[model samples]
Target: MVLNELGARINTALQALSREAVIDERAVDALLREICGALLESDVNVRLVHTLRQNVKKRVDLDELAASSNKRKVVQSAVFDELCRLVDPGVQPWKPQRGKQNVVMFVGLQGSGKTTSCTKLAAYYKRKGLKVGLVCADTFRAGAFDQLKQNASRAHIPYYGSYTEPDPVRIAVDGVAQFRASKFDLIIVDTSGRHKQEAELFAEMEQIAAAIKPHNTIFVMDGTIGQAADAQARAFKQSADIGSIIITKMDGHAKGGGAISAVAATGSPIEFIGTGEHIHDLDAFSARSFVSKMLGLGDIGGLVETVKDMQLEKNEDMMKNLAKGVFTLKDMRDQLQSILKMGPLSKIMGMVPGMSPEMMQGFDADESTRRLRSYMCVFDSMTEAELNSDGKPFENESRLRRVARGSGVRPVEIQALLHQHRQFGQLVKKMGGPKGMLGKMNPAMMQQMAKNPAAAANPANMLKQMGGMGGMQKMIQQMGGMSGVQNMMKQMMGGGGGGGGMQEMMAQMMGGGGGGMQNMMAQMMGGRR
Candidate 1:
């Protein structure tokens, strides 16, 4: 949701076009004007905005699209592609090898979160099974070594830094040699940064590069720097070979269009973006996925990777039960637990088509965390028999009341928890049944589908297996289709809680009364890329 204002304006413009009864050149012009204005206001270069406008106009031919069923969708798709183009450097960033030492050098102006990003990247690679070490060569700034030492210690990553070593070039050389001798696969060298680009900083950077050759040089840029990012990035690019860029403070309320598009214009691919101060908040950057999330459109592949990273697939019992079309209370509890491990609920929930991370806007994240823990407490209060069985064991009113008392929650709250669990259980049963899409396909194929969406490009056949197209249409009609989705987004954008939307959407997908995940997905993908 970085650059949320820009996204909201563009979304509003698109929504207005969708509501229009007529589609013409004038309407198209109006849409582009609104979108272009949003980008310009978000610190994007005027020239880049102009170029995007020209590209959109070229792509969206009203005359050719006149006969199309959905003129709005055509324009929207064109705009989405152009937005992606605006931020894509079109170059692959460097990747670290697992069995060999890979030295990654970090450089940026002071206060750009360069030191923090070093730890973040190191932690990321470490999480992926790499032997990572941190080398603090940032001796120009006072307490730089201590900062790196504290961060590396906190992340449990090995570190090499010297308080007495004033020569950064020598320190960098020694650190890299030591880590390489230690057989660390990924050695991160945190170089010194200055308040501004200067001869001293450039000289130091060059000397360090000469001493300890780095495989990748990452330029860390501050998101709040606006259009100045281009000058900063270009200056650094001139001094050193910037293999990639990482934009920090994207979680703030700053307009990130400048830092993102400006750096991309420099031909330096943005490999990662720092979403928060947390070590795990550094997310791999993907132009298309970034645009999708900005527009509140989900990223299924990203969601799969998150689940995979949490190692949720290691539960053999759950897999076996799922294959047999069984979903016990224990399985639901495990999912909730896995969700907790996945970090904030809003973030993970946004991967669904209709949900946005801002759906819980103005809703305290701690409150959401507390809510999930409360449900876990209810699960813990249950006996082993209740945990292993379906909701049948909790049908007795006394049993439900007793469990609620044990968890210190209201009886109705316990019932609501049970309802949510049962819904999840039912959806899992249908999806993992012998007749279900998951059961019918192998794990490798499912993984392929997640990685390459084109594999499941034609979801009609997949939908038919779950039910029929007619069922899908009927379900969407019941939920009012995009009307319902738009309303939900409006509430979220207004900084209000939109849990009602989530519950209603999930209920429809669960087919607790009607609809199903199959029906919902096909309807959601009707106009999606």
Candidate 2:
């Protein structure tokens, strides 16, 4: 199983605890056992897993939790924080500054994905509106420059490499100098992947590092290597000032333990994660964001930054409307259009709080996309007044049929769209009032929070004001856990409809208000059904 399965298993264990009427030491130990077993199966080092187990046990005092209003929620929050601690080295990764040359060097074992990650990193920076360049300094590997050239060309990034130059050091110096002179914001140097056993290649790595003096020397490790990544990462760190790490091939069936081990090995924070083969697959690394996404909690700030990276035009009116708790069919339609503008449905869903990769896999991306477009068609067929109005305008059966005929979709789908609109509107109304989540948040601060999670972590953050982990949890509590997430997605994805979603299961979470965030994800992912 990959990390997705690992996350699923851990979630499954926690869900078991949610069922017990009483929370105690035995139950907590059982949860820890299941969680530790999942992590161990994923190739996490036994020692680390033991440490995590002990740490969580030490933190979640059952006696204290019993007195707490929501036992499961407090325990879940503890686990989330501990998981974040496991991967985060507590060191700040370096960021490139605009209008200044920032050189980065990549080194790792052969076939560790150093070459591809270099281009992906460059593309990530390029999308941020930075002037980025790539340098191929792998003289040991045949066609290394050719690979970098092909990848760079595909990403439309400026690159430097020589077919005739036999000295990798000279090429490294010249490439950095060229890009430095050209005023590139970020220049990435891709070195030949080498193990510590390769003395000459290790020397070459040192020479290139000395020449470029890269601000960040990244060690790329393959996530599938599991616990073995520790030694490889340590070897590279000894040879170079390996400032940060990038673990590649994480989207595949990686054991996932290797990623955590690599962090422990180098004591360097992960700067980025390569999720797929595409140049756009790279994601900025944050410990909180990673753990949240892994546990099926969405990263709103991360998603906001991603859309911002696209440099799309801002719809300020939409923000004002949302702040006022106003949501109409047009708002929902606008959201669908935005989803279309985003990349793959699965990738986008992974960032959503409730949808984990495992739950997302259950969905057909093409079909979900088609469903979104179909919703747009339904809206397009509606009269401007109808689109702008509340669902009172859709009560006429004849209007529903007319839209159904116009969009060539069943009337049921149109009804489903209206149902979704109603639910979203109700949820928004609850969240946007003067006492709601966005009430105290200025539109700009909300946007900034979405782009920078650190600000969101502030005590004065919007989620805090909303009495939530993000917002959905408290809102789910406030609304008494209306169970429609599954139905909403089932209609949108075309099948797999089931019972009351998470409503019946989590309806009791808000006893005067203590709904855990996992509550919303359970609702969002339909009990992970």
Candidate 3:
């Protein structure tokens, strides 16, 4: 879970007042004070914080509405809306023009993830069914061409670069011409990153941009740079016509606030966010989703859709079964398959509300999947009676050995699977049951839990009161409701959930779950139990 420190603080202040039954002038003032403190702590510009506080105070002062059951919700929604408006102001979504090749040039300083981002962007467009070509024009860096070439091969996109060609401008000009002749729908030029003081290299970038004449120029920056982003953006903006910005490495540090908020301050719209190191780890930027994640409101819609597109119908059906309290080894197999479709487990987990980049960094995706797959194979060898039983039907060691032998796996793998199943079952009971647990979680606490899946299934002391199960139910319903869930399901199913096959096929491929096709079929069947 990427913590939105600034958003979390505002939500916390608002939650304090919601607990009270009566709205007093002093209570509102105190809440505003806390909000101010939180914003400052998050490194939000003092002027922005002051403006936000003034807006909040004005809303509080003008309201004659007494503290009713819904008063807290109303105020909270208002604050959330205002904060979103202040941060994003509802800019039009970015869409690369269709039916023609689009050229995108990446500009940033060294180690800002420009080369990696280029590969990722190519992968992103390739998955969209576009013929993407990569121009590794960053010839100055060691192994820059090799790195980009390797990534392009992995993504199955064409690459153009030369280790021997010392002139980057010539390489870029020729690369674009070659790709154009090949009729590629998109061409990405990965330029050499230099410090702001490198006038020679900056001039080279200008020359390359002019020669290539790219339709879009994206400025990539490390999110951890904080206020330094303003200077970097200014430098890039001055040298070239930068159309958009891509903020990389936002999964760590509190500086995501500074990078994103700085866009508004510096007068540029965010184009994309690099959430991880993988070529498939890029996501389209959405201010609403970003703000919601920051404030501890779980992105239920995003999660469901991401899952639907990446996982097989079998996988999704199995998850829906788990959601409805049905746990089976077949279901477990489907879940593992879904995880595989979703790419790395750690990456998928990071998209959840409270899971931080640090927590995800510790777990190796391949190792976890290998272990889970081994466990599933063990389960496959089980007898029907054992498979359908509530508890381990084969209680004896001899039976475990026989089952493991049949599955050609270790007996310990079976034990591990059982242990995982028990843990997961406990989690489902806590999250789904009326009074099991997760029943008392507040917005901030829920946000934290979203970041930490282990905590998501457990009850916390911070949210012990305030209407318990009923309040949780209301919160869940409000996040997206059943219709929102369905729409997300459609997105996950890719285009197959609606329209014709081509659209559906495109959606499934880009959705990221290896199971897009199967998910489409399941959705067409009405996403039933």
Q: Which candidate leads in TM-score?
A: 1
Among residues 3 or more apart in sequence or in different chains, the pairs in candidate 1 whose N, CA or C atoms overlap within 3 Å are: none
lDDT pick, better of 1 and 2: 1
lDDT of 3 by residue, 33-121 (tens): 88767666655666777888777766654367654445566566667766675557355634677788788888998999999899888
> How does model 2 fare in lDDT?
0.71
Tens digits of per-residue lDDT for model 2, 1-529 = 1267777888899889999888888888999999888888888878778888889888888776546468788778878888888889899998998878899999888998899999988877777789999999998889899999999998899999999999999999999999989988899999888888999999999999898899989988888887787777888888899888888888845497766778887899998887877676777889888877776766655665665553323444444455567776775666556556555655665765565564455566666567667777888998989877777777999998998999998887777667656665776676566766666666666665446433343333434555445465555545444345434443444332322211212211110011222233434343332
What is the TM-score of each predicted model, taking all chains together? 0.81, 0.73, 0.69
lDDT of 1 by residue, 11-82 (tens): 889898888888789898999999998888888888889989999999888777657468788888899999
Q: What TM-score would you give candidate 3 relative to the actual structure?
A: 0.69
Clash count (model 1, backbone only): 0
TM-score of 2: 0.73
Q: What lDDT score is found at residue 209 in candidate 1?
A: 88
**Candidate topping lDDT:** 1
Report the Cα lDDT for residue 40, model 2.
85
Which ranges in model 1 have alpha carbons more than 4 Å from their true place? 61-71, 252-254, 356-358, 374-386, 391-415, 431-529
| Model 2 poorest 10 in a row by lDDT | 504-513
- The lDDT for every candidate, in the order shown, is 0.72, 0.71, 0.63
